[model samples]
Target: MKIILDMMGGDNAPLSNLEGAAQAVKEYGVEIIGLGDEAACRKAAAEKNISLDGIQLVNCTENIEMCDEPARAVRTKKDSSIVVGLNMLKEGKGDAFVSAGSTGALHVGASLIVRTLRGVKRPALATIIPAKNKAYMLLDSGANVECRPEMLAAFAVMGSCYMARVEGRKNPTVALANNGAEESKGTPVLREAHQLLKTTPGINFVGNIEPRDVPNGDVDVVVCDGFTGNVILKLTEGVAKMILGMLKEMFMANVGSKLAYLLLRSGVADLKKKMDSEEYGGAPFLGARQPVIKAHGSSKAKAIKNAIRQAKICVDNDLCGTMQAALDELAAQSAGE
Candidate 1:
């Protein structure tokens, strides 16, 4: 399978992405198509001692800036490496697309290029996050600001399909993010969403789940509007950072604490790795007709490499086709009854 990588799309563009691509190619045995200036990519690859046997290069002259509007950038930045890479996927030149560029650029480019799956209202981004018990999938992670209850339900369905097919989780439980477990809790949106999820027979609707339930590793699928989801996602990251910082400060506050920290350094590192977003790579634009993985802007080689690996799993599992069939089946059932 051919996987496309943006040559200049991250904090350590070309270098980090190239290194990751080399690693992916070596480890995964998949062909990589790097998009950027041909000469630059060649120079970087040479410096890294990456074999160009299966690696392809496509030079793009223009680039969408980090600050550019996604819509405007997609329309005007025709020669950008990201646009080129996604176009390749749309044209069936590649199986999956991976980028560590502007998140907005990826969403807009993917929607416009590869297109959304049939029966899918909006293509939502979903991430498989590590929980205490097992990995859980979070949908519409700040992808759509406001979502219809039906749209949120669609995300649940798609997320469930991803879990069952890709991660092999059978009878995945879907839960609506809310203030409490009682049906009376949350705004009319979530309350109504809870009712819809319950009525939707295909999904394993688990009723309302609080934010605290997420880290507790209770549910497999957590659904929410992008507005609420982005807030919770960012807040979770912020809290993790603050707690780590406080621990470090406490550890260095005195000689006793320092000794204790040294004693527990390995355990602390393991815990930190568990909470590290980089270790999970990036999120996949789940509801689309094609497989697209979005990496963080500040991501390094390892993160980008993991994202590429994620795309391969997505393709191998046929996530798009599985999601399409599941949704079509759900829609037909609704129409029948």
Candidate 2:
């Protein structure tokens, strides 16, 4: 499988992307087509002693900056890594597109260039968030800030398909993120969405899920408007970081604490791994015609490599095809009704 990578898109730019591409090629045996300055990438790879075997470099001069307006930059920066890589995915030159760039730019580029699937109004940004025993997929995680009722219902279906097809979850339970577990607890949009999700065939809609209960691993898919989902995603990250920091400081406080840390070092390491965002790679822009992974802008080689692995998994599982089928079935049911 071929994965198109935006080499010049992230904070670390071409170097980290290059390293990740090399690792992916070696470990996954997948072809990498990097969109960036070919000569500069090759020089950097040489300096770092990283092999670019089985990887092809496409020359891209411009790069979309984080400050650039999403739609405007995507339209004007024709030669940019994001634009070029997305166009390649649209043209079927690659199996998936992976970028650690501006989330807005990647979302805009994917929606405009790759386009959404049939019957899909807007694409949702779906990410695997680590929970108690099982990780749940959160959709609209900063994609569309404001979502319609039917849009949330669509997210439910897409999220369900994603958890099942890519993550191998069976009959994944779907829930709407709400202030309370009650069906009428959220805004009008969410209340209507709740009703819609209850009838969204092929999905195990389990009514509403309070944000607090989300971490309990009871639900497999959590659907929400981008605004709320973004808040949840960021808050979860912040709390995890803060807690980990507090633990580190506590462990280093005194000799007694140090001894306690030594006793729990293995468990602490496991907890750190569980909380690491890098483990899940990146969020997938669901509803797009092709798989588009939105890695963290500050992603290093390990995260980028895992993101590429996610893209491969999405393609291998035919995620888009499965989603389209589910959507078509839903459309048919709606039309019949």
Best by TM-score: 2
lDDT scores for all predictions?
0.85, 0.91
TM-score of each: 0.96, 0.98
Off by over 4 Å in 1: none
Task: For model 1, give the RMSD to the true fold.
Answer: 1.5
lDDT digits (tens) for residues 65-150 of candidate 1: 88999999999999998788888898999999998888888888888888888776667878766678876888888788889888
Error of 1 at 228 (Å): 1.2
Candidate with best lDDT: 2
Error of 2 at 169 (Å): 0.7
